[model samples]
Target chain A: MLFDFEIQGGDFATAGNASSQIKKILKQLNVDHRDIKRIVVALYEAEVNVVAHAFGGKISAEINTTEVRIRLVDEGPGIPDIELAMQQGYSTASPEVREMGFGAGMGLPNMKKNTDEMHITSVVDEGTTVELIFFLNQTPPNH
Target chain B: MIVKEIVEKLNLTVHSGEAGLSREITGGYTSDLLSDVMGNCDAGKIWITLQTHKNVMAIASLKDIAAVILIKDLKPETDMAAQSETEEIPVLGTSLPAFELTGQLYELLK
Candidate 1:
């Protein structure tokens, strides 16, 4: 199955729509409970990154019998230093955003921790793209 | 323990999502940052936070959190409450602050 979702920047009200929808679909497909949790966490962080930093972005997810791959591409001021941005305490979110309990610098690291394989690419002043993969075959939901 | 028992123990107000009052509560987490909760909170745990936005509900649903406890008597926004209803994740409120509420909750759960 393939799912595509568009994210609007600064739209906190609707930010998690895509993640929520994807969760339902994953459940319907009988994805393992553990895998669904990991995938949903990674996907929600990616969606929030777009809403917090980019003007807009698109998420493409491909789910097969064995694994799920997600790609998030955003248009905005891309990250100049991916390594620093991945740090546990690093964040560039606005004060207002922070007040709402976001932008604590754990987003990328969490995404990486939840996925089996993850890659990130960004260009300053241009855009950013992130790829996350989760292997669903290793441990079934009930395992 | 289930959410309704905690509600009785802590004197928390059921702001919305009464349908979820019976959900089991395995644990509790307190964080103002959404990412912290997302990365750290376990499923079926109750989330204790001060955020009163709609995104909080989104995170609760995504993480499969049993319920949300709003601090300092903070109330959920209109739409946030609506989402709680739709998602069937109760958004409970309390006049006690985060620290005190969490302490009592931890004691009960422990």
Candidate 2:
């Protein structure tokens, strides 16, 4: 099955709606609980990143019996240094975002931690796209 | 702590899901950011926040939070209450500020 959501920036009221719908779909499909949790976490983190940094974005999820693929694409000031942004504790979220309890710099790292394979592509002035794959057939390696 | 005790001590209104007032909450987390709440909060804790949005219920459900307390008398829209009911998570409202509620809950837990 496939699902798509248009994430609206600056709309704190509806930020996590997409992730919530994705979780419900995974549950109805009888996806493994552990796999679903991981996917949900990664998807939510990506969604928050889009809301915090991007102008707005789109989240798409493709689910099969064996794996789930999630894509987060945002149009905004792209990451100048993907490596630096991926580091835990590195954040550029504004004070307003931080006031709402985000911007701790854990979103990207947590996304990487929860997924089996992750890829990020960005152009400084254009935008960023993040792709994450979580395999249902394999156990999450010991952290 | 039982949800009833929290309601009594905090002087909160049962906005919805009164059936869950007897539910047990082992701990409490107070944060307005849904991300931090999702990352650090364990299941079955009472989530205290100033946010009054429908998505808050989604995070609580995802994290397995027992109940949600909206501090400072913040009120969620009707749709948000409906979502909480559907998720089986009780939504409570309180006139106490977030900091005061946090301290009060800490004392109760202690």
Candidate 3:
């Protein structure tokens, strides 16, 4: 099944709705709980970025028996430095966003941590797109 | 400890889901940031924060938090309360400031 949602930027009240809906769908689809949790976390983080950082965005999900793919696209000022943004404690979130308990610079890192694979594309004046994939058939590797 | 005791000790008002007061909470995490709460908080911990948004309930649902206490007497909106019911997580309100409530809870749990 496929699901898509438009994520409005700066809409703190509805920020996680897309992820929550995805989580419900995954649960009903009988996706593994661990994998579902990871996907939900990654989706929520990306959703938050779209709201807090992007001008606005859309999230789309494709689900199959073997895997799930989530795409987040936003028309906002693109990241000036992807490497710095990927650092665990680096953030450009405003004080208001931080006050709401986010912007600890963990969003992207957490997204990367939770998903099986992640891809990011951006342009300075244009926008950013983040794609995350979770495989249903593979267990997370043990350390 | 039961949520009721935590509420009483903190002198918080029950915003919704009074029945959840009977539930046991093994630990507590106090934060306004949903991301930290989600990334670090253990399942079933009582979450205390000053944030009274609907998204707080969403985070609680995702993290499986035992319940949410909105510190500083911050009352959640009606929509937020409704969302809590939908998520089956209780939302409690407290007049105590974040620091005071955390201190009290720490002493009680200690």
**In model 2 chain A, which range of ten residues has the least summed lDDT?**
A134-143
TM-score of chain B of 2: 0.93
State each model's CA lDDT, in order.
0.93, 0.85, 0.86
- As a TM-score, model 1 comes out at 0.96
lDDT of 1 by residue, B32-97 (tens): 889989988999999999899999999999998999999997999999999999999999999999
* Native interface contact recovery, model 1: 0.97
Error of 3 at B108 (Å): 5.7
Weakest lDDT window of 10 consecutive positions for candidate 3 chain B: B16-25
Q: Which candidate number would show the highest TM-score if scored against the true structure?
A: 1
List model 3 lDDT by residue over B1-110, tens digit each. 88888878777788986656677788889987677787778777899888877888888887778899888768988878988877777898877788888888888887
Ordered list by TM-score, greatest first: 1, 3, 2
Model 1 chain A: worst 10 consecutive residues (lDDT sum): A134-143
Q: Which candidate tops DockQ?
A: 1
For candidate 3, write residues A1-113 as lDDT tens digits.
88999999899888889988998898898988878878888889899999999889988899999999999999999999999999989999999888777899988988998
TM-score for candidate 3: 0.87
Model 1, DockQ value? Answer: 0.92
- Tens-place lDDT digits, model 1, residues A49-143: 99999999999999998999999999999999998998988999998888888988999999989999999999999999999999996764466
Candidate 1 chain B has its poorest 10 consecutive residues by lDDT at: B31-40
- Residue pairs of candidate 1 with colliding backbone atoms: A101-B34
